[model samples]
Target: MQSTYQTAALNDDYYYSDILYSPYQTLPPVIQDTLLDRQRIIVIANNPSITQAKLEALLQPTDMLVLFNDFIHAEFFAYHPSAKDLPKLLFFRQNGDSLLHFGLPPRSNNLTAILEMTKHATLGMLFGNTDYQFPLPSDDPRPNDDPITANRVLEIPKPLDKLLRSQEHCGVLSEQHSVVADYPVFADIHSSAPTSGFLLYRLLLAACLEVQQQKNADTPISIVMLGFNNENKTANFWEGHNWAFERQELATPPHGVEIIRQY
Candidate 1:
């Protein structure tokens, strides 16, 4: 019953080239260009099997957090960045979209749906360009609390909550009626697997919530992460982080997206 699908079904669209630098962690000029103008991104990992630690090594801390979910393109994007590469730390999304997506290498039309979600997506990319196995610290320090196994919503930081609360486009019940009108999505991260795609969606919303809550009142530029999980079913404050299998009851809208803000 837990079948994976393409980023398209989730209404995600964007062109991404993993390993732009080839063995280097630096992003491609196009990515840099897009990021310079906008910071918030809704990356679609599509595959969680890939190691995000290796990929983190390449990104600057200013890059922000990565929300982990789904299983679409596992091999292409994860495992590129390493802890050292993070020039800045960005947050990830925590909401769930109530939509059913099918398989990988989705049809062109599905790709179009992924594109629709990208309207406000600034930059999205996978963790690593190659399938490198690397050890990474879990988001939760407690071993008993494996994020993937525990299907529950976490309390987003105050900063992130503030941002999401401030925005009107955080959650979208329909694919066509999303935050697209709010802004133009810059990039979409891609990898070789499907789970990574789910993670990317989570990261996007989480980052947005963080930025909105923490940025200085005078800060001119900010980034927003947006994502929707279809399987999330929790009454604990609309935070998007949840487990697919644990969810049995249907959500109110039957769909939800969490937006995280990062400064």
Candidate 2:
């Protein structure tokens, strides 16, 4: 039982005005409805232009736990009295540099914790970059000195793992040249450019679609692509390109994930 929802048209001035710039106190009803209905939700933002004020404003309404790429962004919510008071507003930092620099409270970096968070996340946004290394502690000696390794590893969680595994292993946009992972769920995009944000957004969408299809779930999934500007003006790898959501006939891939692209 697959159903389609339409995102508001993008304004010419802003990259994602309908979503990123929408009023915080009263978000679009569609967004509210989807949040209420969906079993799984993932929001991806990589736009460097996004400010602390904007992020905090958007987060004010939800009880979602956020996984930030660095302490720069995580600190706002992590330290704010209001944010701290919300027991549901948990945060995790993926960047070891920030973790080591700030010396914040440690949270479990185990795969089990990640899986549990993904399964239960009411509203989640993952920032790209910050170099998400996995299965290794943030304080690991190897990454301490030479943070940007000649070779890097990108980790994919279980929910996303299931979705990517269903595809034909096209390399991710980021690690295209590197040795790809042998497993269907893991592979490198092999590019030096910063494309993780875009890739993360795509993967999150794919994962949500896969879950809905496989589970025969009827709840609607709403996606807001934050920080993508016209002409790929942002630092994301896909420069000179712009993406928008256009209404089209719903088409499901072999993996049973339906994707809606701009016409």
Candidate 3:
């Protein structure tokens, strides 16, 4: 399926409509009314498209929202200063989708393994350092004149490998009745960065799962990051690591949520 982001690009103008009731509307009563429902909704926006003020207005009572820093959803999530507190209402980028799809360094990582295993896969890597906040406008390809683009910098925590390699054991979950089973399960994705925006995305998914659980535990929710699509491999082209993407351990769902491998 085409990601919501890819669908947006196909349109003549870059505008995409929100499916939920928007706070941007002039109707305060309407906005107030929807907020009362207190539903778990996932809001995804391209970076720079939203202003701080606008974000503040939307976040007050939202269950969760995911924001992308650029055209592709990689940079902001991979290397943003605000990664730590990891607001349920925010996600951003410091670079591009490539950073997330192709992880940095030695070719022995999970991403490398995937490329080698999946014949003729397409690859991309995205980067994020929990310890480093991406520079707003100081030195980057991002446009310089946007007033909304304040020249700010932040510091995040380190990457996952540092944290995981230091640990002795990691937990594993296997279940067929859970939500993760409904979709074609790829391996679970995780990040080592403490402020890692992807964690927030995971939490947001948790919240959505909670909502789904309240009604029916059997229903499955399908969520794919906006910018990553690896498919239609050619049998003739099989260079290992050429199409690799980085991903860490799978996360265990909180209490009532079960993460099943749907393969």
Cα TM-score of candidate 2: 0.36
Cα lDDT tens digits, model 1, 120-235, are 33323332222111212232233342333233223334433333333221221121122112222223422112233333333333323323334422321232332333432323
Which of the numbered candidates is closest to the native, going by highest lDDT? 2
Report the CA-based lDDT of candidate 2 relative to the real structure.
Answer: 0.32
Candidate 2 per-residue lDDT, tens place, 30-60, comes to 2333334344332324345667665556443
Give the clashing pairs for model 2: 172-189, 174-191, 175-188, 175-189, 175-190, 176-189, 176-190, 176-191, 177-190
Q: Model 2 shows how many backbone clashes?
A: 9
Q: Is candidate 1 or candidate 2 better by TM-score?
A: 2
Point out the worst 10-residue segment of candidate 1 by lDDT. Answer: 100-109
TM-score for predicted model 1 compared with the true structure: 0.24
Query: Which residue ranges in model 2 land beyond 4 Å of their true spot?
Result: 1-48, 60-68, 81-194, 232-263
TM-score of each: 0.24, 0.36, 0.25
